[model samples]
Target: MLIVSQALIPHQDGVTLHPDLFLWDKQLADRKQSWFHAADRTPAEWYASLQGSDVTALLARQIEVMPAATSQCWSVTPYHGQLMRDSIRVYPEGLFPWCSEDAAWLCSTLNPLLAEEGMTLLHSGAALLLSCRDALDAKPLSFAAISGKMLPNRHHEGADGGRLNRLMAEIQMMLHQQQPESRRQRGEVDVSGIWLSNPVAWPQVIIEKKIAVATRNPHLSAIVDGQNATVVISEAERLDQLVKGNVELPKRIVLTGEGYAVLLNRSLLPTFGKPSWSPKRVKSEVELISKLSGWIA
Candidate 1:
């Protein structure tokens, strides 16, 4: 099984705060094995690597293959954030104890407001950006997606080129105003806003292996879905149980997040260390893809 875990390895300064991950890293090092850094740093980029196709072409195919009942699909992820002066500081989902009830309530209340703008919201925080009356024949005006684990600091760097900036700002205001008093009294961080990433259609990929993907990330799950792989929506911390279950093991298993790759057959234990490719060494996605393709082959 091949496991891809979310940011399990933190930067040097974060080691103290992430003692558990730090210990896991040490265990991998003791075995003289470490995860190889892929061409992309974000989970989205890492997932893109698994697809053996051009991203633009893949998205186009998604539109072609989309069910007639839905006009378009955009990955919308909820996040908790704080307002620091004029800038907003978004926190990872792990920081909050969000339940399914919270997700459903937010979707139910917000979907109607969004529908007026030609979008239908789903329970998984996805929005169907509709363009026509006939769901089966509608042409999508725009396609967009976002990673749930992104930091507000990076989004401020104009990653989305200000496309969803105004939309997010509006959503932030709405969340703040509609935030429940009960939640505030409980000291939970406000479900402040959301971040939008990759605006593309889904791709159609052929599945050849019995692949099992263990992750709670919707973006990762969407990618794996294209490959027709079975998904186990569990947090990274609970991955050991999935890996050691009695069920038949898949040919490959991927854990997406802080980005680790473990060959379960070769390494009986989870290992961590410096990624094989450095930012300085691999400057482009093409180079990273080529390197990873060769290594995995």
Candidate 2:
């Protein structure tokens, strides 16, 4: 079984640490040698590399699979960003609490207005507002692409990137002008703006094994669909219960957002190490995938 978790380690500096994640980090330290350096810096890129899929394709497929669930063809997610001295910093989903109902109401109100500008809006998740352009000429956009340790200078970017950034600013202005009373009543954090993410296309891949996926990330589920796999969607806290059922355990299991891959057989474990730390540098996605190719053989 393989687990891919987000920020399972304190990959970034200055971000507030969660107590539960800190405990998980301690447990992982015992098996530090087993940890794999993420192929890409951000979780979005890492996930895209893992599935051999791009953000645009994934969002397109999601819209096709669940039309009612989304309102756009291109993938752009929203987030609550805070204005700093010189730039804006996006808040991670862990820092805020949002309800589905509020998200739905917000989207409903914004979609109609946004549609006037050749775009449709959807609430991808509590912390994400998904957007897709009505025209096919524009490239897909993502908030994860722009956000990082430093704030983005949207004024000095390429045409496509700049356009997307401008669109994001426009959406934020719209939300601010019409702040929902429901959100205010609930005393939610003042949503300053939105960040876009998952701006790639879904790839077509075939899995020969009877695989099962246990994750809360919709992208993970979309990747495994039509590949003779079972997807169990549940919150992070209740993931164990969701995966531990009476059915036969799959030969291969992937726990997305957990950050570790487990091979059930004893023989394969040693090829890597004793699950203890090594001074080796992190490997790229291609290298890591090549290393694990033997498992399929």
Candidate 3:
């Protein structure tokens, strides 16, 4: 079984997070393409090697993934001052053998359930930090994604997908109460960017050039201008480079799926942070619940 550890690190302006909050070693055959074998190695240790040196990191203890049926099967009691406090069931009764397709299916099926409770499903893995009001009041919550991009795995892009935007909204709402603003003042903003996975695969100098393009591009100016904007990058190296500069620290930098990303800018970040549901999952569940003999909504 693959043991994954997630961390929620608070930051000066926001929070930094390791999104893979839920991890259990699955049989290697299940992760055929992602087959990783490091004897007694934790997820953090595995990810650390992939990210390289110079990046400070922390790894939490492994959280067991006990498969079960029912609405309350999977639950979490977050630490005091943490964002997660309720139990969230990613799968319903009789839904076992969660595969990559199932993960995607769950994203769409569960989003509405989450929205009903003022929450949503993100397209990335379960790793995130929340920045409320300011740096003094921030929290990070991590979880495993039902489906999304996995490093060293397949890359799939969706058109008009609003997963990132939805995530931004959830974060904003979580922090709105703590970071209230007066009338006529913008509460917060978010700047997000995507980094090419392979660009960093090149030499450091080549990767540096890409960062130059991001900061210099007209499209990126909005990121710097907003009081709260999240810069989402697909490449980790690019994010590391940005931190080295004096640019304002985002409220949260989230590396989701296969993209190196960040969500920040108080007002904008929340707006864009909202998450989207998975269409495939939702459609299938709706059909199953409608046709299954024992199904009840």
Candidate 4:
């Protein structure tokens, strides 16, 4: 099995992702396509599907898969605050570039509030992780899920979603109350909010001992594999290049994007007889995207 993260755009419209996205690579793209009908998810969800419970619970369980590994229990995201009228917006870490001092101070101020709800915030090596007195039933959205999106609406999700949503509100209020708006006006980065993962268990990941890993996710490399699969983790812009980099296909190649993943199952070995290009039907981008967009939804 091969897992390629960001294999497609989370919000792809009619346009082809890359020039050679599908038409140029029939061996992989047209092998046996299987698209998912579920809602979109963050790229990290695709990676965490590779690890066992121990490894997962051990990363809030996985942060856009996090800055570094830690034994700490609860995972948190240092949201780059972009306050809007009705809701807040979250930016990627690149815009904020969290500092140790900022993290420490934020923790110092927020820990007390967090303690009231049986939670503690700690600065764990360039990222933030929350520690809970009990197992948390609800977790915030994966940081990657909302990197440049509006904050998720207050939805009743998971077992303890009510409490989780309340906590998010309190944190946002705390930041704004602590002069974050002023700080923003002065052009300074502020950790005014945080996000956590829903802890998704990908029903899609195939457990194979003998496997080769290729990824941009920092945490998945710790996985101990034996050799039958080749997992490729790629950024949005580089999916085509990564696949092309390895012309040899595994028994199957799972190309996953946000909300959905497609399976391309075929023989692992390179074709021995007729070339894949013998009778290629290169459909116009319009035809392909029209059919694909339906299933992707």
Per-residue lDDT of candidate 3, residues 1-297 (tens digit): 011212222345333343322121111112212111122211222232333310111111111221121111111111112123352122211111112232233345445545554333322122211111111111112222221112112222333124433443454354344321221143322111111110011011211111111221111221122233232222222233234433443332222221111211234122223222111111232222132212111
Mind giving the per-residue lDDT tens digits that candidate 1 earns over 1-297? 344434344455421113323324433333422233432233333444545543323332333334344433444456776556766555544344555456566766676666555555544322212122222221211111122333443323344335345555777778878976656778877777654433433333533322344554443433445344354433344345444533444443332333333332234655555532112221333554464445444
lDDT for each residue of candidate 4 in 264-291, tens digit (9 for 90 to 100): 6674455444322111232343343344
Q: Best-fitting candidate, measured by lDDT?
A: 4
lDDT of 2 by residue, 170-214 (tens): 778887777668777888776565555444322333333333444
List the lowest-lDDT window of 10 residues for candidate 2. Answer: 261-270
- How many residue pairs clash in each candidate at the backbone level? 13, 27, 57, 12
How does model 1 score by TM-score?
0.55
Each candidate's TM vs. the true structure? Answer: 0.55, 0.60, 0.18, 0.54
How far is 5's C-alpha from truth in model 1 (Å)? 4.6
CA RMSD (A), model 4? 10.1
Worst 10 residues of 1 by lDDT: 137-146
Give the range of the ten consecutive residues with the poorest summed lDDT in model 4: 274-283
| Candidate 4 wrong stretches, greater than 4 Å | 1-7, 10-34, 37-44, 52-56, 60-73, 92-106, 135-147, 177-189, 198-254, 263-297
TM-score of 4: 0.54
Stretches of candidate 3 off by over 4 Å are 1-45, 48-97, 116-119, 124-297
